[model samples]
Target: MQIDVLIDVKTTLGEGPLWDVQEQRLYWIDSVDGRVFRATADGSEIRAWQVPQKIGSMALRKNGGAIVALARGVHFLDLNTGDVELINDPEPNLKNNRLNDGKVDASGRFLFGSMDTLEDGPNGALYRLDADLTVHKLQDGIVVSNGPCWSPDGKTFYFSDTWSGEIWAYDYDVEMGSISNRRVFAVLQGENFRSSDGSTVDEEGGLWNAQVYEGKLVRYAPDGTIDRAIPMPVKNVTSVMFGGENLDTLFVTSMARPPLSRFPTDSVQGGSVFKITGLGVRGLPEHRFAG
Candidate 1:
């Protein structure tokens, strides 16, 4: 496999690499910078818009525009005008909590989780936004939420709490957009221990996770066993997604400024988005938010 910097733009906290199949473009966000970016698969014609608050994730809308999870709550973003209308604040009372990583399910519902701004307590929760624009809380007692994804058959859901050092799997109900039977899918331990930042599933059911602060892309088989681990050029790798014409190229996003004091700020290509080819694998097309 070969990897190289695709976009040289520097972002404070780059996360949420999203591949748009219909539009044949890639979307990503600078979490702490409140910036949303879009570009062709070749990393050209890049366009970025600044949100009013820090952004966690963004989903393409079936009709148009996008649904963005900002620091305050969920909002409908008009990319052309850079106007955002608040949908709802599921945690209006949680002063220290903010919405985080999220993804669209096969049924067109957007599922995302919250994280504590202080990263101190388990003050966060998981939520789902349906097609009717209604929000529902799915799970609670999370510290830092990240990596929301599903299996190929839509039966298994994967999520992680970054500070908890664990990635959990849930039995997902595709039709109802509900999750249950929460269990540990994998633990970050041993010599390779590192926090899970973001993830994407391959067509063959292998989950590729970016191990933040560890500079590695680790793939776990469907059974939660480590399939392989590929070292990254940057130490603060944030997220990954499969883009390109054949959906075989892996797009990676990173961070230039470390969030915590423990991580070094000076790292090679820290904020550059990367492209990986020769993986010999493809990813399923991302689902659009029905709302």
Candidate 2:
């Protein structure tokens, strides 16, 4: 595998990274600073704007701009002007909670979850937002909600609760956008491994996950078996996504300064984005938010 550094920003808490296919650019957020950054493919030009609140994740919209998940609620973000238009606040009463991770499903629905900011309790929940702006609660009692993706055929759904140290899979309904039969898909086992962070699916339906404190990306077969382990330069590999023209490129994002004083490896470029090519595999295009 060939790894190349895309951006050496070293954001305080670089959590979300989305590839804008139309503009051929990458957009990511630093949650701690509430700043969103846009960069060229080659990292030649970079621009940033401060959002209204802490941005945990975002999805590219089919219409334009991005659907942003923040501490308050979901909103529409204008990439050019950094303007935020509120869509809806799913959890207006939960003052101590915030939306953490989310993605658009095949049926043009948004699936996201909320996490407890204190990180001391199982207070998070997973929810689905339809194209008509209707919201449905799917799962609950999560600590750090993350890594929501689907299979190539949209028949399987995968998600991760970082604090659980495990990943779960469910039988997905394409038309209804529902999931059932939740089972263990993979368990992150290792003394160095802390939790499973963000993930992506390859063309062959292999699940690729970034383990936070492990400093590695574990790609698993559909049968919950280990396929391979790709080591990372940094410990906190936040998220991974498929980008590039043909989706042959795997874009990995990381964190530089976490609250923990310890690290799994001595990586100097901890808060940078990386691209992995020559893996002899490709990833499916990211599903966009239809609304």
Candidate 3:
């Protein structure tokens, strides 16, 4: 099936793309532009929300708000009023670090990662936010930590260290909130694609990952086998998510960043949200922040 461009957002550095089932809307962020956007499934009724700093990701809450990963901390955002209150700040001393890709686990806890903004910093770290707003460091020394998807049964965790070019899986104990037995799940075998970015797991436990710098979205089986490839019209495919009433519609977000000399024209689908219909399995409902 041919993928169609739904909307031309023209984002500078588009990243997190999420689906809000209750509201039947899509939410995403422009990390560099510090803007959060929401729109309908057909790319209508677009609205932009301004944030004080760069936003990495956002998860809806059960109580009619959202939990957002801000520059260096997590905040509780009032959906109706747009008021943001800081909840927790990890690595406040690290001036060159900021929150990156993230999502809420099935248990409603937020799992996010940080990356080094400074050129020579020691990579980054992955963290988990518990029910009481306590942040715990799960993994460290990650260059660009992305994807944090859970299997259909919640038995496995799929994540990517974007600079490593490999997707890793871990045995997850949902009740205990722990991950162990880490193993490589898949690796991108191309020179143009440096690593995997945001990803989502389908109902059949398949992974759909955005191939950054390669301008493609790839589907893979649970056993680390390639299933199919969906090409995008632009480089820097940042993230993907399944939405729509039946959850069979795939939404993709891309970016138009530096090194413009390589691609002279900005006329491509650089910063737009594209949609592919009838090509995805239903995704698990997003966990809401109850606390």
Candidate 4:
């Protein structure tokens, strides 16, 4: 596959690349900077909007605008006016936790998980936002949540707790937007174990993930075997999504600096967005947030 930089904007902690099929555009977030960026499939007509709080993840809305998982709560973001309206905060009591990664389920519900901001313990939980604007708690005791994706058939849900070093799969009920029968799908083993960040499922049910610290894009078969690993130039590849007229391009996001202040970064290409083409596989269209 041919990989190249698509956008050169330096983001402190870039994450959450989203592709809108109907609009044929790409959107991504700089989590620490609380910024949302959008552009055409070719990286043209780029525009950015500042949100009120640090963003974790975002999904396009079925009606318009976007639904963002911000630091304090889930909110509706107005693209034209850049206004943020809070929907609800499921864990307002857990001041040390914040929303992390999220995705829209097949039935148009938003599923996201919270993480312990201190990276110390499992004080976070997963929640589901239904079309009626109600939030339901699903799972709990999570340290750092990331990578909320689904199998092509919508019968399986995949998620990762970065600090736990394992990706888990669950039986998903599409009609009810609930997950059950959780099991470990893959584990990060070996001396060069890479933390899983973001992921997307291909049309063939292959899960493509961005291995954060290892700077590699890895694809895992549905049965949890490594299909391939493509090394990247930067050391902090953060997230990935498929976008293009035909959804054949793999768009990646990276981080210029570490999440914590104690760490230092040195890669010059670290915060740029990259796209990989020439791969034979394509991806399913992302589901929109129904609410």
TM-score of each: 0.97, 0.95, 0.94, 0.97
Tell me which of candidates 3 and 4 scores higher on lDDT. 4
- The C-alpha stretches of model 3 lying farther than 4 A from their native spots are 118-121, 258-267
Residue 73 error for model 1, in Å?
0.4
Residue-level lDDT of model 3, residues 146-248, one tens digit each, is 8888998888999988768799999988886788899999978766546788999888888999987777899999898999988778867889999988888
Q: Between prediction 2 and prediction 4, which has the larger TM-score?
A: 4
**Regions more than 4 Å wrong, model 4:** 190-193, 261-264
Query: How much lDDT does candidate 1 score?
Result: 0.92
The local lDDT score (0 to 100) that residue 187 gets in candidate 1 is 83
Roughly what TM-score does model 4 have, to 2 decimal places? 0.97
lDDT tens digits, residues 160-259, model 4? 9887878899999999988899999987653454478899999999999888877788899999998998989987898999989999999999999988
lDDT of each: 0.92, 0.85, 0.83, 0.91
User: Candidate 2 lDDT, tens digit per residue, 158-191?
Assistant: 9988978789999999899888999999988767
**Winning model by lDDT:** 1
Task: Tell me how far the alpha carbon of residue 110 in candidate 2 is from the true structure, in angstroms, after superposition.
Answer: 1.0
> Where is model 2 poorest over a 10-residue stretch in terms of lDDT?
258-267
